[model samples]
Target: MSQTDSYDDTYTESQVIMTTVKIIAPFTLTYGMFMSLHGADTPGGSFQGGAIIGVTVLMLAFAFGIEPTRQWLKNSFVVGLVTGGVTIFIATGLATMALGGSFLEYDAFSETFGIAHYWGMEAIEVGGVALIVAGVVITLFFATAAGFTPERNRREDEPLEGVSDDD
Candidate 1:
């Protein structure tokens, strides 16, 4: 294919929209980070931060195409992100357990390790959340658009014994 054909093939966005998202995306991402960071100190927290980050990736997917995005975001990365996030969150609780404390006792971690409670909470917020949000969001966004066949199959999709197609 020629250069013109290549341009046609790409899932290119309009200039105006592209520029607008470009301008807005950074702030959106920053806000997401802020959500995670501020969760312990303020109203926001891990889950919300994760969702925002996920939405940011979804927006990028909207801006580009699934295939191209998939090219950059491999399965390993997605799995790693999710698994790593879970590990971070769980490990915090586990560490406390190991230290003979209750689950997710940030104060325990602080007292044991001579670290601040806020820092531990931030770890839970940023590490646990950011990865989980990014992984799940990106995975779901791509999976939903992957065009896979339903699990029900032809037999399951067929009408019930008493039901008619017309009915």
Candidate 2:
């Protein structure tokens, strides 16, 4: 049998799982945002919030099938999330340096631009750490679920040298 034929791609739908995910996804997402936004003041931080957000996607995948969820969430979107987060994080640090302060020195914004240090911290939490964590988690989940496939580019009829179907 070919590699593609050896893999089971079928999904058995479950009404209970689907219904539960539908009910829970929104609240989970909202809580994640709240954690990220309020992290500066509250117990939760960007990592926690981002992890929550990533788990929401995982919940969806479990309910709706991994392939469907992967199709719905394009790779570009994930890449953009990670890229934007890193850029925001780096820019925030660089901005502090540009203002004659050390990297990631929130006081610089407060001193030079009259911006509150709290806002700077919030930006790092919400725009930087949160996005990076969410994107990374999702990427890891998808990669693990997909598993590894060798000779992906080769045709089904093409055989790997020295390997025989008789084996």
Worst 10 residues of 2 by lDDT: 1-10
Q: Write the per-residue lDDT of candidate 1 for residues 1-167, one digit (tens) a residue.
A: 43235233457667776677788889988888888777777786767887888788777667766687788777898899999999999998888888767898878877788887777678788898878987898888887877554343447657645457787
Alpha-carbon TM-score of each model against the true structure: 0.74, 0.87
Alpha-carbon lDDT of model 1: 0.78
Regions of model 1 farther than 4 Å from truth? 1-12, 150-167
Q: Write down the TM-score for model 2.
A: 0.87
Question: Ten residues in a row with the worst lDDT in model 1?
Answer: 1-10
Tens digits of per-residue lDDT, candidate 2, 4-123, equal 466556899999999999999999999999998886898989999999999999999999999999999999999998999999999999999999999999999999989799888888
What's model 1's TM-score?
0.74
Report backbone clashes per prediction: 1, 0
Residue pairs clashing, model 1: 39-44
